[model samples]
Target: MSKAHELLKKYWGYDSFRYPQEEIIASVLDGKDTLALLPTGGGKSLCFQIPALVNEGICLVISPLVALMKDQVDNLMKRDIKAIALTGGIHADEVITLLDNCVYGNYKFLYVSPERLQQDWVLEKIKNLPLNLIAIDEAHCISQWGHDFRPSYTKINLLKPLFPNVPMIALTASATLDVKKDIIKQLEMQQPKLFQISFARENIGYFVYETEDKGYKIEQILKKNPEPSIIYVRNRKMCHDLSFQLSQLGFQTTFYHGGLPKREKEKNMHLWMSEKAQVIVATNAFGMGIDKPNVRTVIHVQLPENLENYYQESGRAGRNGEKSFAVLLHHPSDTVSAQSQFIHSLPDKEFLKTVYNKLCNYFQIAYGEGIDEQFSFNLNHFCSQYQFPVIKTYNSLTFLDRQGIITFSQEYSEKIVLQFLLESKEVIRYISLNPQDEEVILAVLRNYSGIYDMPTAINLSLISRKSNQPEAVIEATLLRLKEKGIIEYTAKNNDSSITFNEVREDERTINRVSKYLEAQNELKQNKLQAVLDYVTDKAHCKNSLILNYFGERGTADCGNCSYCISKKVTKSNSEKDSNVLLKLIKEKPLSSRELQQITKISEEQLIFALQELLDNDFIKVLPNNKYTIN
Candidate 1:
């Protein structure tokens, strides 16, 4: 066996590689630049992982997703491999120590975000490490045409000159041909060997059902399948509502979304992953690092924004090589909802300018100043202060972040600080007089060591749990105590923060990236239109439509898709049903309901069959609506 196969078996416990995996690994082992266009469940991580193990040095991986990076690093470490991921929020001193460990600790893999590469110190430190291969995950972000483009990705090529001999591999789950070429050009891959797995899953059947009564339809589908499944909704509230509805209908269900706290998210995810919960209703945030192979069904209750996202999300099913389903429950109103939720929220250039100017003013940054300045940003306060619409303004800020105008960090952390302004005896007397607030005050004093000496930050949740009081009640009690001058309280409420990457040059900054922005918006519109067409189209096979959209051709109709099944039923089943109906009528003139009872078929099929017989003059309708031979 080759070294690659040996390592794969040793670590992954697989006897052989999946299709195209061995070939891709060979190309990388031969010191060639490789671009791999594998679908979502295509095992893209192992392509570079095994090569790094076979080589003598660490593999440097640059990825844009902090969660995905942490997941991969954790998985590698479980196999006793030395790996580290430099995610955000690490202190400067800790970052230096971690980099030093990478240089001297003989780690096999080091994953860093693309934003980290922009720092000179990080780049200089990376230059000192012995590198075997450089891999870029989600390489599509380097292209403006890609769905989730990030400007930091364009700076990845800066490492090419540093590691002249080290081969590079770029990997993405979904990328069009245009994005592919742009990734190559932007990353400066020299004659890169391209390996593209067809964006097709033969075992998974694609299905779409048009229904106004989506709840009933969902119940019907889940009843038939009744396996581990996922239901994708457009927002958080729907996740909760549908999960509850499904649970009430007797299916073990849970829900997940980004707004969920960390502990709750993990608990819910564990329930689904362990099969204690058979279904997980979630938003798009739930699938980033998830790799459950036995997902039997993935149902979209609302219209997806684009085929790229839909394909990736639906592709999550049947990874165990068993037959599974990817279903979409569509209503006519979904189109309008998609337009309002996705397209209408897109910020135009004028809105972008207004938002940029307002943000500058909000931070009190003068023109040509505020470079490298960081501020805690409360999005609601900013919007309310400027009377700007929340969604559009948020999108504008996101656009600016993607354009590299600012570093937006959306990690949420709530801080509460307090100190006792009165003596200990006085504080005790006040708490004793107000017995309702006693438990919370005692909880804080017991938990925080030096609350009497200086202001100290506290965890509100911990206090609430200890005091057996709700967080809101604790806050109210604390406010009451502060009003009485027994203690000092300060709450810093913010959901996100931003760091200025450029000096304030509002309009010029927007203009510099205006063309790219316009092109991206147009691409989004085109993608949304394609999704609309796919859902509304009844003539084409669903699987074939997806394949052609991804640039593959010469595909035959998949017999398992909704279109093929419908066509088959219409062409052949209708004839079979008609014959059964005619024979029954010839034996005895019978009512339609009696015919339905004897045929043991659906009312819909029976009605269609009877209509066909009537059209062909093979049967006559009596005054009582009974069927008889003509």
Candidate 2:
């Protein structure tokens, strides 16, 4: 067997690669730049991972989300693979050490954010590493037309010049034709090969329902389906509110959003994954690295701003190819609300300038000062002090960051560090004195090394699990140990960070990207219009509409979609009842009840046929609640 196949079997226990995976891997192994457009749950990671194992040097993976990086790294470690992720909020010394490990320690994979590439030290260190391949996950972000555009992704071209001979692979689950072309152009790939698996997911049944009472409708759907489900909402508050409502409706449910602490988020996610919770109410932040295969339904309470976002989120269902549902509940006011909230509320150039000036002032950086300085930012406090809307303020900050004025990273989790202060004999003596703290302390010591010399990052949850103790007890014991001066413990903090990229600039300099920003705004508006069009359209097949929007054409109508099924039922009823109505009307004008009695049709069916016939001018309704031929 080939080395790639052997590694796949030994590590992932897979006997064969999925469709297009082996081909993409072969292309990369031949030292060719490649782009793989796999759908969600199509096993995109294995394409890069298997090749990295087969090759001799380390593979550099550029990812966008810190959570996704951490998840992949953890999974790789569990499989006994040496992988490290350099995410935001890590200490600079740790980063240097990680880079050194990649160069000398024979690490197989190094995952870093695109923003990290902007650092001179990082670039210099990467240039020295024995790099074999450069893999870009979520590659669509490199393009301005993508739903999640990050300006930092454009800086990735710098790596091409640094490692000219190394092959590169870019992967994304969702991208339009325009975004696909732009990704290749921006990355400057050398005659890259393109591999795309069809975006159509045949197993998922698409559905849309127009209703006023969403809560009741949701309950009805859940009761009828009664399977593991995801309910996606727009905001954090709605996550909690909908979760509470579901629980009240007799559902074992949990909620997740980006604002929650890392530990809480993990706990809720574990509950859902383990099937302890029947439903999860979440925002878009919930499902990046989640690999649950039996997700029976995905319900969208509000319309997403674009089809890419919608497709990616809804695609989470039916990974096992079992029958599943991707349902959208649309209220009459949903479109207007979505447009006002997502488009009109975007930060204008003047507003962005005001935010930039305020941020500089808040950080106490004089104009033309404070370049490359990092600070722990409290966005809530800043917004409260300045009386700025939190969402709009966040959008403005993101704009400034994308314009290359600053680097704003909101998703950062604090790292916990622990150091043993007591000598070995002294530690034994203290442990004897405090028997209650013995289990956790011993677990920490057994799991981690070099704690006597310097603080090491510790996973308290892991310690709790191994020690067979509750997390709260383990935390209290650590605090007691700290009080006794036996060890030093630093609890994790979840906060955001900001780094000034360029020296403080005036309004004119801040507005440099105004034209580009306007273009982005227009794109967002157009995308929003597309979403509205999908929800309001009732004539076409839902699957066909979605496929066409993604640049696929001539897709057959999915016979099982809500629209198709409704059309079939309507046609059946009209054909059966219209014949009777036409025959009765031809004999004589008659009352509705008389026609129903003569045709032996139910009242509802008779009325429906009469309406259909009247619509076609084959019959007409008279003044006294009677029917006649037109």
Candidate 3:
């Protein structure tokens, strides 16, 4: 058996790697950097893992998602192979213990965030732990043009030599040509083998529709699939409303989003995972870490900002290798609303600066002093109290955290940055007296190279707890470690600053970028127009036009889509209902409830058909909750 096959069976109990997996695995096994661009559900993890195990050392996997890190690590550990995830979730003491185990135990996979890489100590400690491969998941984030760019991804360059002899593989489920180049350029993969599997999930039909009655359309699709479906919405409120509406319609639906209490989110997630619920109504944040097979359909009530995002979310369907669908529902006016949302979200820097200043003042710190303090932040309260923009301010602070200027992601961690307070030779006597302390100190010196840069904020909390020393001892060891040129530290209090490495420019540039985003918003409106055209287009294959946008060729029309089914339905039910409603209402005013009972049509569907008639001025709604034919 091939070495890859051996690990696959030994760990995952799978008989064979899926399509395009073996090739990528072989390339990584050969100690050559490789980039595997598989579509979502293509099993991108095994591409790196198979070769990672085949190689003689641990694989260092860098990712941006904390949940993804945990899930992957859990899967690997369940197979009896050692894996550890370092995230902001655990206490400092826990991170230290996990790292210690990673360094000294038989662990093979260490999943960490890119932001964690910015810590000099994490870099230092990871430098010499028998690393044979570097696996960068979500490699698209390395690109500035990618939707989820992280500045910490750029810092991954420093870990290059820590595993110089180790082959590296960068894997992503979605990346356009431009995003691929940015990943390559940013990660500095040297003439790596490139493996791109086809992006087409031919089994999943693609459909785009426009109708103001989204609930009706959603109900229509779910009625057909009726098993493990996901309804993607743009906002948390919609997640609740859609789920509630679906449940009210007698569907077993659950809602999930970030804003919900973690327990509620987890409870709903568990229900979905257990297949206790048939459908989940959630924001884009719901499925990032979820890996459920047999998801029959993915429906979107609102268009995403970009195709990358849309593809990732829609790609969640059809993972079971069964025929499924990706449906997009939008209306002509949705574009206007989406544009308004974009404009509202993009706030001015002055307002952002005011919020930042207010936060700093609240913390009772001058600019640049809140290093290493911690707080539980209620964002809504903070925004309302200060009278600054809420969502935009939060976005700005997060962007600053990404830029590595001031770390607000500290909430996820009991964060501390250690600065080596002493020179290497200064603590020689103490290290000689304490060999155990000397071991950690030497590990630091061996791992982290730039100890001379004073105040290089180190994760002393992680180290003290990991090294099993007191916090003061952690502090002293850091001092001793610094004296021995091992590591150094500093801390950022909960304070955050905007550090974009971006040029602070005049209003002209901000306005310019904002306008460019505005134009993109306009193009989104254009895409909505295209959907309008596709729904109404009679010239060519409707499936072809939609799939072609997703970079697939003409295979066949989805016989299931509304466009294809229109010919078969032949009853003209929509028109018949409209005509019948018009005739009845013209005779006298009728309530929608009365109309539904008399016509025997669904209330939601009746409401929609009535609204369309109203829009056409064929009917009008009376002030007394009755409809009158125009």
What's the lDDT for all of these models? 0.85, 0.84, 0.68
lDDT of 2 by residue, 381-424 (tens): 99999999987898888777665567676664555789999898
Model 2 reaches what TM-score against the true structure?
Answer: 0.81
Error of 2 at 473 (Å): 16
lDDT of 1 by residue, 466-555 (tens): 564555577778888889888899877556778777789988989987777778778788889999999878789999999998888779
Q: Highest TM-score: give the candidate number.
A: 2
Q: Pairing residues by index, what is the TM-score of model 1?
A: 0.77
Q: Candidates ranked by TM-score, best first?
A: 2, 1, 3
Off by over 4 Å in 2: 89-97, 368-376, 401-407, 412-495, 499-503, 506-509, 571-630
TM-score: the better of candidates 1 and 2: 2
10 residues in a row with least lDDT, candidate 1: 461-470
The positional error of residue 70 in candidate 2, measured at the CA in angstroms, is: 2.5
* TM-score list, all predictions: 0.77, 0.81, 0.71
User: Would you give me the overall lDDT of model 2?
Assistant: 0.84
In terms of lDDT, the best-performing candidate is: 1
Clash count list over all predictions: 0, 0, 31
Extract clashing residue pairs from model 2. none
The predicted structure with the larger TM-score, 1 or 3, is: 1
